[model samples]
Target: MAKARILIVDDSPTEMYKLTAMLEKSGYEVLKAHDGAGGVALARQEKPDAVLMDIVMPGLNGFQATRQLSKDQETAGIPVIIVTTKDQETDKVWGTRQGARDYLTKPVDEDTLLKTLALVLRG
Candidate 1:
């Protein structure tokens, strides 16, 4: 079977690079977008296996993007995993409500990220 394709939506170049490197090393095909609108567009066009969303951004934000993806019939089947710096309980709850399969605080642990990805892919 082919490796999963993952879409990473983050405005920060550093965070994007880190996540891209990690996912690539773990054998996932990584697609990237700099902001929420771009991410939503890419996700709709590519229909990637999963999405790694970052919360804070200029316009649209991760929460709004995730909600859009989840609600859209074209991308609703794709799972979203929010990878943000926000470590609040409410954030986690809200992310799930927005249709995230899981939430992880950044800087993310490689092991946890891989494990979570694997589980999400399986389910």
Candidate 2:
């Protein structure tokens, strides 16, 4: 099978590096964006199999970016999973409402992350 292409959108360089390392080690192709607008652009251009999006960003923010990607015909099928510090139920609900396929909080556990990715990217 071809390696899954995942787009990770987060402002923290450290977090991006960590996640990239982990996913790459697991044999996945990873693309990254340091902010929401960049994330959206990459999503459209790259057509990644999945997106790991951060909620808090400079200009567009993950929720808005995810919404745009989900609504756009070119990128609407990409599965977006919100990964952020927002642990509130409302936040998860809102993220889902904005078109995130799944929600995860910060300090993400590797097992769960991989499991969610597997479930979402199975094709």
TM-score for every candidate vs. truth?
0.98, 0.97
Q: Pick the candidate with the highest TM-score.
A: 1
lDDT of 1 at 21: 97
Name the 10 consecutive residues with the lowest summed lDDT in model 2. Answer: 114-123
For model 1, residues 1-123, the per-residue Cα lDDT tens digits are: 988999999999999999999999989999999999999999999999999999999999999999999999999999999999999999999999999999999999999999999899888
Per-residue lDDT for 15-70 in model 2, tens only? 89888988998999999999999999999999999999999989999999999999
Note the Cα lDDT for every prediction shown.
Answer: 0.96, 0.94
Off by over 4 Å in 1: none
Judged by lDDT against the true structure, how good is candidate 1?
A: 0.96
